[model samples]
Target: MPELPEVETTRRGIAPHVDAARVTELIVREHRLRWPIPPELAEHVTDQPLLALERRAKYLLFRFPAGTLIVHLGMSGTLRALTEAFPPEKHDHVDIVFDNGRRLRFRDPRRFGAVLWQNGNPLTHPLLAALGPEPLSDDFSADHLAAQLARRQSAVKQVIMDNHIVVGVGNIYASESLFRARVDPRRAAASLSRIEIENLTKSVKETLADAIAQGGSTLRDFVDSDGREGYFLLQCYAYGREGEPCRVCGTTIQQIRQGQRATYFCPSCQH
Candidate 1:
């Protein structure tokens, strides 16, 4: 699945072409996604100019006058901005044809993605209403993280991965952030000191910011709107380097299962 950075990268890639463009038509090749594509999606959005493009957590928001179009690139979904002449592929499930002869295409082979419509404030919609603060925003600082962690006895890794605590810190990021903070993933969330929280918060922000700058980490089936793969995976410190020497201490990186997800760290470095 595409994490925050990857999602943000897609938003940035397609925003220029789609923003302010008028939707000429809506094409739904398959409505049966994670949630069925709205049946009257075309009626509501057609001929309407897209006001803006924003990302909330993992969902993409296409803002218009009437409402917003919310998109989630589930496990293996990709959205591309293509010229009108671009041919649709096998899994291309939907298209928002623009009056400018450009189209935004959505493809999801596994069919777990979503294309939904909202007639009211999209931020108040159930899917997004309770989502925590964006990890890259000022709202997700050390103070916020500490307050949340203080109430949870779960493993620090699991706590950080919880969307309710801080949205978009996915499995890979959680491991990498903990490694950077030199905090063991298995430590209880409430056991972290103020200094540890500060370090972890800074690490999370830096890791995610760096990944976004590098265009996100592409493990598989993830690409920007331009069909380009991300290069951040090349700089990973511990996420997938199990049994490899740590970059900082030359300690062999270890891997463990936390909440059924693989976590990597340097036992000699992370306490």
Candidate 2:
């Protein structure tokens, strides 16, 4: 699935072509996604100018005068900007044709992505209403993380990955952040000290920022709106380097399964 950085990258890539452009047409080739695309989505958004484009967690918000169009790139979804003459491929499921002749196309091989209409404030939508603060925001500070973790008995990585604690700290980023902070993934969340929490918070922010700058980590089926794969995977420290020498201490990186997801860490480095 595309994480925060990937989604944000997509938002930035397509914003210039889509924002402020009038939607001349809304085409839904396949409405059977993770959630069925609203049959009336075209009726609601057609001819409306996209006021702005924003991202909340992994969802993309296309703002308009009447409401917002919320899209989630579930596991293998890719949104791209193409010309009106561009041919739709097998997986191309939807397109929003703009007055400028550019079309925003959504392709998902797995059909796990979602397209929904929000008639009111998008933040109040049930899917987004209870989401925690954005990980890259000022509101997600060390103190905030500490308070949330103190109430959870789950593993440190699991707690951090919880969307209710801090949005968009997915499995790969969680392992990378904990490794950077030198905190063991298996540690109980409530057992972290203040200093550890601070380090973890900083690591999370830095890791995410770096990934965004590199265009996000592309393990599989992720590409920006321009159809470019992310390069962040080349800079990973511990996420997938199992049995390899640690970059910092030359210790053999180890992998374990927590919450059914693989976690990588340096035994000699992370406590």
Query: Which tens-of-lDDT digit does each residue in 1-271 have in candidate 1?
Result: 8999999999999999977889999999899999898899989899999999999999999999999999999999999999765777899999999988889999999999999999889999999999999998999999899999996889999999989889999998888899899999999999999999999999999999999999998888899999999998899999899889999999999998988999999998999
TM-score of each: 0.98, 0.99
Q: Distance from true position, residue 173, model 1, in Å?
A: 0.7
Clashes of each: 0, 0
lDDT of 2 at 98: 91
Model 1 misses residue 155 by how many Å? 0.4
- lDDT, residue 46, model 1: 91
Please give the RMSD to the true structure for each candidate, in Å: 0.8, 0.8
lDDT of 2 by residue, 177-207 (tens): 9999999999999999999999999999999
